[model samples]
Target: MRPLATRGGSYVFPLILAITAAAAVACALDAGPVNVWIFVVVIGGWLITLSLHEFAHAAVSLAGGDTSVRERGYLTLNLLRYSDPANTFLIPLILLAIGGIPLPGGAVLVEPWRLRHRWWSSLVSAAGPVTNMLCGVVLAWISAGIDNPLGYALAALALLQFVAGILNILPIPGFDGFGILEPYLPRELLERLRPIRPWLPLVVFAILWSVDGASAWLFNLGADLMETFGGNVAQAAVGLARFRFWNV
Candidate 1:
């Protein structure tokens, strides 16, 4: 099995770098109460999303016959335990304080070799995003059912989770979705794509940040889906909170 450090370097490092840089730039460029609220909502929403993400990873890994994540103490909601200080704390804090980017939080661990089935491995990798989407759906449901500020907050959180889930599921080289897809891809194709793997994180981040339309489209789609399932109340709550600072 490949070492965790190697896997992270190959897949996670570039995302950290790109997001951190973009965050710094966003902080520098945006100066408004709305931006601040968006930052706060993102932070709160990301915290919940990330925790579930790591939990999904650890859970699936355990089910797949890997005790590595549990052995390493990654099976909990303890943020500090899963977080890499550099990736989760320092970079985000610096960007938020100096650059104005919304720093995200959450973590998960898995052992590739221990996964017995390639498709299962793919499912495990895909679990995080699925969990996020579920979370969004639940939140949206709650928001629509209720008639209060709490409902609005839930709606916002749902939006964040939905967006994050979709973003992570893009079949880019270094993303989790790619990892899930990798095991099922033809060996020849996988091999051919290997050399370019390192660049994928950067490419995904660029596409996400540079293209406002893409991001908006994703968010809208998430909202649409959530509305479809959550009914009118949830849809209204989300719409009401869409431009507001915080759900309140």
Candidate 2:
């Protein structure tokens, strides 16, 4: 087996962080178009979280005996290594902008057969969304006491990440939630569901975007969770409003 690289992290991650930081700082100083900054912050921050989310899946799978993850460069924070750009970024960004639903993006392929145990598959699936939750919690904590435009933007981003985690954990086909339960499900049941897995996420996103009640329920659920975690839901709304500049 090949040893995992222990050297420096991919420069792409740091560059993304730098760009997001620059945008946040600029917004804080009232430099440019508030809408532009809001766009940058939300989009860049979301990309960062997506990278981490996929990395978590790969990392957990690696630990669970899938050395192929390292070979595929999934351990690195390079966004290109994750998945198709259209699915990983474009579609999710469109959904976020139009409906305020942060659909989970990016995916890591974990060879279930290579895993040392069946439970490893569950852990591999759970790791991605759990990372999102942890990110939401940390961002929520950071923005909790700060009452500023930047803070509001952070709060909004936190809410999105939290919602993304929630969406991923839903027990539906093509989601990590289903992946978590797949190991315990019967083989025949899995076979029956296999054909539908590819299009399930798209259908789910379409429902969430096109149906007002469904979108409202999801946003409300996310908002409630954000408030419960001490995030400023009102400010998050403001931030989202700014992020969706076309609506303003």
Candidate 3:
């Protein structure tokens, strides 16, 4: 079997990039349905980031000696390669479109024991969110140079990425943030928490959705990080408004 690292990449990522580029060009031209074009740019870009986020985890795991990630097809960059396609792509996309929430996507499973060290396991967990943060910074840098409406859209997408990075790094159950610390925690505590791991994310999302203060606090932090990265928070908000064009 071909090594996972050598496995061919799926056309989906590049295809989305191409379409998003075209939509961005349309936005540049001040085309009709500008909102729709912005939507395409933001959603398509968001999907690309999601793919990269998971890929970062798999890649780090592979480096840390978890070769099983290869056989599981985690290196493909194909969203379907993940165990749950809906969680990986569909549901998050829906949440983004409807409410502007950038929920973290499906996880790539890693065998912690197979890794070379405890630090490797933690690094593997940290890789995904770090990737999101880096991507957000790069997009923000790109957005900073553009004076067009497309800049707003890109900034909005960058803000989403920043929010994802921040959200994932929180030390909450079922989050990468928690995963980073899992290796250092008492094994007894882990066993106690294991049963509730699956449900915790759902509960967390529910709180964010229903509790105004919680959601505001989260977004406020994201906005602050966006500004720190040189992104225009107000412009990103405008981009988000355009992205949810139906509501505008």
Candidate 4:
């Protein structure tokens, strides 16, 4: 990892990255528990990816003529710079730990009105989740060529990337997928959705939580996508099983 000097003076993310990376490496080297390290690696690597996810949005928005994101410090690689810490990190982490479902995380505020064209909004919105998809596909492909513990690690990461990509790409309120469609949404509908937009997450997650077989559907879909992209779902499952420290 390179030196990250940020204007926000935020070092927690780097520290988190260092600790997690060290733990993951140590586990891979047989110096630590495998299950614990899987957890650490997934969570830590996820935080970094969250930063990149937001970066994609900000970067695309800037290129599309929304220069305000840079001024808003959205250009920073710090995870804290992406969105609400509670929403992006804490809540998603808690949910993943307990439910093993990858919830949508992080946000980058881009002024749609400032965009060069309406399509630019779609581009900016699609950029974040697509980045996650690329990471999953690339890493899954890489993991296929390797063996054991290391392959396990990469597979797990790839599975997560698939989960994030699938979840974010759905056209749901308070999700990036829906943001892609927001540009074409009627103003009347936007106004109608205004009050419920905040609660939509709760509603969505609640259904996934309370409904039977919802989590399985998500997991199966994610696994299918990961496999389609050249990832081994079985290995990813082993990695996930090991990482379920609470379950094991």
Candidate 5:
């Protein structure tokens, strides 16, 4: 049931990364409109990491014994590999623009029975956020050592990765955090909760967006972690402030 994403179709994953790297370098160099280009790079880079995030789940699922991941194109780094296009990209992008929260980006379906152990399921769910956290650490480390506007851009991106990691691990419905908890829940309870999973993100989003300072608190925690991990908060703030594409 291996589904390789190479059927006379698109293969632009590497190209996307290359462009993002170029943009990051440009920002570090203080090229024209650093903030605008940083926006493009961060968004584009996030998309790629989003793909990898889902891929981590699929890969772990496969290791745990599910072969369906490949068949469903879950291994593909393409945005088109997502189970739902709108849910996969649009909702997250809109929310990030409005509230700065990067919701769980994509999903990879796995067969529960095929998992090697019940606990393996939790690992599969945890893998995605772990990858994000690792990415944030790497970015933060790099940003902390560098001196210039480039560090600012990298720090901002690192902040985003940290926030994304935190959000995905929150035990909310449809999110990996909750998925990790599913292995321990009773069958009847799981069935009762299943129906509302699809709407959970919207509910959470509405609450956070409507509640004053909710989103800010989330970002602040992420910022705290970023600083502790060596990210330059002041530099990141400058880049974040400059990333005002909507402020025309």
Candidate 6:
């Protein structure tokens, strides 16, 4: 474990460099009026949102008397400390380029049994999505306060983060939301459901692939909420990158 951590630390910088280079090359080769600034903002917002999600998990874990996560240094915004390069960087980019559904990676090295309360564990799990929603709201407010392309881009990024949060929180196996709900579900029920865990990714993928209209409906609903407070700015931001690309 110690060697893995050391190796991971060593490889982190190079991996990020490689991923950035790839993204830049992909963007340059694509034929369109790509808004580089908007892409940057959206990516930045997404990273920030991911950080918050992981930190929330660590925070709740600490509050629940779990020092394991703290020892692992996961209670901060440093994405490298938590992210799995394969899931967070490589796979997502590949899926995005190939027009497939992207899946974000979850946090690193934490033992749930160390927590003080099982309920707090659930709360910690749920915190990621909630934090993303809060970030979206804040970004929407900021976007409404200004009137410029940059503002629009920022708003759009926020909207994407919001959608990501909601999607991640869906109570499916291997998702943080499922972890949150697991504590509350009866142990016997979970045992019965255990057999279905391995097939969850396929099920989730199918849902995303098959339910085109459903995603649109969810986006529309999110847009409506954003518009209620921020008006057109919110709508524009939320819709700007609705189906533009998949960011795993």
Query: Could you tell me the lDDT of residue 199 within candidate 6?
Result: 80
Write down the RMSD of all candidates, one decimal each.
Answer: 9.2, 3.1, 2.5, 3.5, 2.4, 5.4
Cα deviation of 243, candidate 3, in Å: 0.6
lDDT of 2: 0.83
In order of appearance, the predictions have TM-scores of: 0.69, 0.92, 0.94, 0.91, 0.91, 0.75
Q: Give the poorly placed runs of model 6, Cα more than 4 Å off.
A: 1-34, 89-104, 228-248
Q: Evaluate residue 121 in candidate 1 and report its C-alpha lDDT on the 0 to 100 scale.
A: 83
Q: Which pairs clash inside model 4?
A: none
lDDT of 6: 0.62
For residues 1-248, could you state the per-residue lDDT of candidate 6 as single tens digits? 55222334545445544554444344345423335534544454455566677778788788888887777777666666664656654565454334323354665555778887788778887777787778778878877765554565556655555556666787887777888888888889889889988688667756765787765655566566566546454435433653253441
lDDT of 5 by residue, 169-192 (tens): 888877889989999989998899
By TM-score, the best candidate is: 3
Location of the lowest summed lDDT over 10 successive residues in candidate 4: 1-10
Off by over 4 Å in 2: 1-10
Candidate lDDT values, in order: 0.60, 0.83, 0.87, 0.81, 0.80, 0.62
TM-score-sorted candidate list, best first: 3, 2, 4, 5, 6, 1
Off by over 4 Å in 5: 1-9
Estimate candidate 3's RMSD in Å: 2.5
lDDT of 1 by residue, 1-248 (tens): 54332233333334543553454344344435434443444444455456667778788888888878877666765555564646644554454333222234335656778878777788888888888888877777766765543444456666666666776787877567787878878999988988998777666555655776755676677667777666344543443354344443
**Tens-digit lDDT track of model 3 for 9-108:** 5777888889999999998887979999999999999988888999999999999999989878898677767767788789989998987889887658
Q: After superposition, how far is residue 209 of candidate 3 from its true place, in Å?
A: 0.8
